[model samples]
Target chain A: MIPLSHFMIISAALFCIGLFAVLTKRNAIQILIGIEFMINAAILNFVAAGRFDRVAGGGQMFALFAIVLAAAGVAVALAIILNVYKHFRTINPDKIDTLKN
Target chain B: MSAEQLAFYFFASLTLISALLVVCMQNLVRSIFLFFVTIFSLAAMFVFALADFIAVTEVVVYVGGVLVLMLFAFMLSNKELLSGLQNIAGGFKFTHLAGLLICGGMLFLLVSAISAADVVNLSWIKNGQAISENDNTIHQIGIHTMTRYLLPFEVVSVFLMMALIGAAHLSRRERRS
Candidate 1:
């Protein structure tokens, strides 16, 4: 049987991948997808943690709330990105430098 | 291996692979589609992990609702975006190395902690088939969400409504009249 450690490790790897994507990708949508990946990794970790605490199920409940929140956040972020695209005619976040350092 | 372990492997593999595809694919539409696959697999894994309420919410809010909205935005935005794509040759190298180091260190810490901890008897896996029991069931989740977590739940609902109104305002086209 695959232990909880395995799940945690895989989720950690996925989280790393998502971080890498967010850092490296220039497209706003790609970054959003990466953000989704990161959140799901946390959800996976929570579920794995919740397996032992089966009575209160706090981890599972938190995970459910987190999933909803992630979706809402992504929805709003995408809308902003789309608005940025309309003004800029491109979605490359690196080049959209209206308020950059 | 038991059915539980087998199911875990199947769903976990699907989720991870699809997630990888979501990040790696070059085409935006293809990446979005892969994202749907990833979310679906994750929800399935949550269900197998005995988080039935979470699984349904994940599928409903993320895969169904949010993804559709993202797809709509993609369609509304410009289509010809080939030249704008970045060449990942140089810009991300150092950031990627840093990310690798951070993630690897965190993984090492987590594994060591799990191995060193003697706080709980992890040898006792919960009854995987006993999800129907009232303590961890959907009924308990609903009751707790309404009673104990009522304040935070309402707060989140208000936050969501605010977000919706703000998004509509932000994305609205300017009137030229």
Candidate 2:
């Protein structure tokens, strides 16, 4: 049987994986996926923390808000990526150097 | 281990594996698919953690709704820019090593801190203990939204509206003269 500490540890590992993905990936969409991973890790932590917090359920509620916000953010980012693709014909992110003075 | 602890391990493993795939997979579509799996597993974990409301939101908002739209956008922009092996470094071995070391250190520190702390069960952390068990879960959330979190909620709505307008403008091809 797993322990709460194990959940916390696994969440930490997931968070690290997401962080590594965000830091190492060159593609914008991949980075976005990393961001999604990070958010999910946080949400997992929150929900787990909320298990013992039945009264307020603040952590659980926050996870809900986070899920919505992540969706919104991902949508906006994809639109921007589409624009990036249209302009450069490439989405390598590192290659989008026109705006970078 | 206790039943709660056992369930925690079960779901935690699911969350970690899917999350790893979400980052490591090279194909964008596959990556997005893994992202959905990760979120669903997380929702399951939330349920196991006794966060029914959060679990529902994680599934509905994240898996059912958001991931679908994101994958649709990914398909729309599926030009396959890089050859998946262009000038990219061949797995920066040193960097990967360094990252692992640092992450390992961080993990050790976190576990130690948690263990060392004189912690007790935190059930008495808040007032109005019956709030979670009440039938008006959504209704109570709404009340809190207006009473305490109204400003942030309104801002998020505005942000969503702006994002919608911006996406529409950005995606529309201008009629060339």
Give the 10-residue window scoring lowest on summed lDDT in candidate 2 chain A: A1-10
lDDT of 1 at B16: 79
Please give, for residues B1-177, the per-residue lDDT of candidate 2 as tens digits.
788767666666777887777766666677778777777777777766666667777788777767777777666666554456344535666656776677677768766765665223333432324333335556656666676667767888888898788878877897999
Candidate 1 backbone collisions, by pair: none
Error of 1 at A7 (Å): 2.7
RMSD (Cα, Å) for all candidates, in order, is: 3.7, 3.6
Report the error of model 2 at residue A29, Å. 1.2
lDDT of 1 by residue, B63-85 (tens): 67888987887777747764334
TM-score of each: 0.84, 0.81
User: DockQ, per-model, please?
Assistant: 0.49, 0.50
Among incorrect, acceptable, medium and high, the docking class of model 1 is: medium
